[model samples]
Target chain A: MTTMTSNALCFGDEFPASGAPCFVQVDGDGLTITVESEGDDGAGEAVPFSALTVSAGGLDHDHLVVKWTRVQGERTLYLKSPDVIRAFRETVPNHLSLPFAQAAEQVQQVRHRRRLVWSLVSGAILAMVLGLWFGSDLFVELAVSWIPVEWEQKLGESAYRDFLSHQEVMKEGPAVTALGEMTHRLTEQIPNNPYRFEVTVVKSDVVNAFALPGGYVVVFTGLMKKAESGEEVAGVLSHELNHVLQRHGLERIVKSLGLLTVAAIVLGNQQGLVGMMNQLGVELLTLKFGREQETEADLTGLQLLQRAKIDPSGMIRFFERLSEKDQGRMEWLSTHPMSTARAERLKAELAALPKKSPEPFTFEWKQVQTSLGSQPVAAP
Target chain B: MKSEILYPGAFPMVRVDLAAGEHIKAESGAMVACSPTIDIESKMEGGFLGALSRKFLTGEKFFFQTLRASRGPGEVLLAPTVPGEIVILELDGVNEYMVQKDGFLAGADGILIESKMQSLSRGLLGGEGFFILKISGKGMLALNSFGAIHKIELKPDQEYIVDNSHLVAWSSTTSYSIEKATSGWVASFTSGEGFVCRFRGPGLVYIQSRNPGSFGAWIRQFIPVSE
Candidate 1:
């Protein structure tokens, strides 16, 4: 072993954490600290000067935190005054100094490099967050396109089943059969229609009509009762059909829950609609289409009605009647724009389109109304 | 510069006394009181881009407030938004320390504040945030935490583990890894003990008794929702 040369001796032994009396013996020019353990055994260990890094505890420092190799617990020594700090500083040679101000110079150089590294990292993180946010919409849309039409139809069936459990349904009635025939006749006109549509007339007084994620067109008896003619009922159904065809509900689900959750549900047990709708029904039931989406549905539904030789004016007339009647429970219209704005906007939109000869559509409207078990409520 | 923790417990405040020409940098919105002789100047730290980076990555304010005793020794008071204790950590330049992103309140001059982004894998595996605030150089650094700060002195060949959200700061000498507190992911999640920080010593670590995340979540429930 190479003999270490230094000045200090028993530096750690003199200062006991419990303030116990200890003695030190100097052996050579090299300072080897022999720490006498405070235990009853009075054991001692030799510590070399190089194994220690001393901190002078500064001018106003309360205590000194001296790092000595192999020592456990607190090694802090209380500084009585500035003289004690200077005295402690004098113990270590200039080359072995650990003063605050002197060490600050070397740390500054390293800190400069660290600042540069952090700035770049921050910039990269910001860019990553923005990219993920913007790219997500396009990415999710593309993924949604790959989902099979069969899954959507199952989802709709599940939602319809959940709705029936939650409320009353008018299944297998003349009213439901008539509404089903009208929906099928209208749906036949759309070439390559992807959905197997089913219209259910729910036996409730709520003046609302909505389209589930799939092709389930849910029309309340109140909606049929409130309608003045068969064409008005057809107009509402056509609007709901557009919502299903455009996959707006699925788009919203992807946006809210993200691709991961959708993928999880898809990859999970495919036990029909209850598996999906049981978890997602609340959010989807109150799903509000944005202004842009509402406009798309309005314009697209108008074109579908026109192609089926049905007068698109029935769409505007039904909206105007709802506006004047001030019926607030229409979930279909509740999430859209203000009633007056929608009414005026739809009327203006119809005026811009080219005039097409619309057939005066006729059906057993009074018979369907009688089957609904209510007269049309007059606008007061 | 001389620093003292007034109250020294929950709701503790830092009172820093700056000598002539001495300066102190503090987190923005932390200053509650200051002597009239002290000049408070706010500027972008390390220049504009540096400040912007800190703002984005560390959630620090765009401007770092510097209090200087230009003429004579003056005092400034600093406090954090939450009710907590503050610790005055004195460094002699032998080591550097890492602090939780929101733990640092103020520091004596010559103390450089920088942020470090942890590896993505570590961040995903642990509860500690992606970025950690590093206080380096020679000076006093004040750290704030909910409730009182408990300092743990770790010995060599010993490993200490702390909940990630409860950990506030640790000495630079300690090597640490972000890890799961429990053996399995299912057990970790179900037990409500997720990720924790495992520190190997010999060094010091400061932790708070209460977690700010849980406290914030508790407070959030009582707040009224606005349309």
Candidate 2:
């Protein structure tokens, strides 16, 4: 029974440039639009509410548009006032208001579905990254187990010859004899060891040592000069020797070969094996072991020195000293990344082992240092 | 200006005869030939940003070629890039048309072409793309289709379902939503008719006889691929 009256614009069949201004009255069954012109009396056009199709219109969709058919053609009316639209919605029958309500519900559903899809996609990507991270490590271990030890020996021999070709190797000297004694003691302790355990002493000012794939260990004279005792030098040799025993260098190379190349090698592809061997010599010189591999070598090296009856404290003491003093200058520390946590872990491990008094080596440590000429060889 | 469709079925073209100083806007590169008196100039119809949006958003041409009979009255022939039929629509000021991308060929001076965005569901799944051409104002508008064009007039509240890819244009009075062609999602894709537009009308809907997507996929098998 309530009548809502508001100003509106009516675009007739002709759709004139500007719509004619009209006064709209909402009655029980329909809307009566009366055009306010000079000669037109109170007689207005009455359109049934059921006959109108309401939708949002205007350039910015700010106005409510209602369209319906008439005798001449289609007619459109624009309601721009918020009050009129609210009144119209409140007064219109339930069936007439259903479409607007349905449209609003559809928008809500779309936004909800879009948010769900985004979360699912991001979660899938995260799962894939985690899967690859853990899965690749297991895959590398499986592939490395398939490689023959003789092939590793050949790979290490080639890499060793290539490295010594570029450096001044101390072929015979008191430093070589001292290093030989340490290598002999370490290798004698290994049970069923397959490697020949060849150790080379290179004359250089950089304190560094590395082990190749098979049992080739390279020691720099600078490391010998830096050692306070023969036990310290033996400590470093045992750590490098563990790197060889664990096949850490080969593990690094196999990991870098990626999934496809490792699969090929595991499947007995001779071409892939030959291709990898050709690149191993160059890759060996620059390869840096992962932190896990370093920790493994550290713990296992302590056990090897324990079995050799050489003091295990020498190895931990050498690493702890290098980490604190001239950390940046020592190439060994740079490659090893000596953290305080590593030193702490090593100390805890040494404490757990049974007490044993280690015997000192026969050679004098100072004589070995003095035997290496002090010209200070440039770092290569 | 007066326009007529020549070669009505396949390989159809629009021949527009212009009066002095009268112009017709056609899709760029649509003109096959023009008389000596007719001067051709390519212009971005609704300024730089408008044309840029139309190009990237709706996949329409960046520029529209305006053929003006500057010197005197002249005739010009225009054709679409593909071989298809051309339909001419007479637009009254009252009703507007929503056209699929690349459906427009040429229009008289009074017709205004602008890009319009549809609702989210229609834009994402409709296959007609997100942005479509909104043709309004009063003039003759020529539309080209990949195949024969069919016109259907529906009474008020009448419902008709159209395959999304085959749709050409429809009157603004009609409301449509995108849905799967069949009731089931798996069946819709297996039936080779995926998404469809369901329109309720008191207006006209234009559809083409062939689907361009299927035709391209058909031809792709015959082409040799190199490794």
Considering summed lDDT, which 10 consecutive residues are worst modelled in model 2 chain A?
Answer: A1-10
The most accurate candidate by DockQ is: 2
Per residue, candidate 2 scores C-alpha lDDT tens digits across B1-227 of 78999989989889999999999999999999999999999999899999999999999999999999999999999999987899998775545778999799999989999998766567778778879999987789999998899987755456899998999998765678778988999999999889888886546788999899899999999999998
Q: What is the lDDT of residue B113 in candidate 1?
A: 77
**Per-candidate fnat, comma-separated:** 0.00, 0.00
Model 2 C-alpha lDDT per residue in residues A1-380, reported as the tens digit of each score: 12323266566645332354567777888888776542156668888888988866442234567788888987777666666677777788877788766543554565567567656866899988987787877767777777778867877887798789989988998888888888898899999998899999998978999999889999998887777788888888999999989888888988886545534543556777666655767788889999999999999999999999999999988888888777335999888988899989999999999888998888987777778865432222
Candidate 2 CAPRI classification by DockQ: incorrect
All candidates: DockQ: 0.03, 0.12
Which stretches of candidate 2 lie above 4 Å from their native place?
A1-45, A48-207, A210-380, B116-124, B172-187, B224-227
Can you give the TM-score per candidate against the true fold? 0.46, 0.61
- Alpha carbon lDDT of each predicted model: 0.69, 0.81
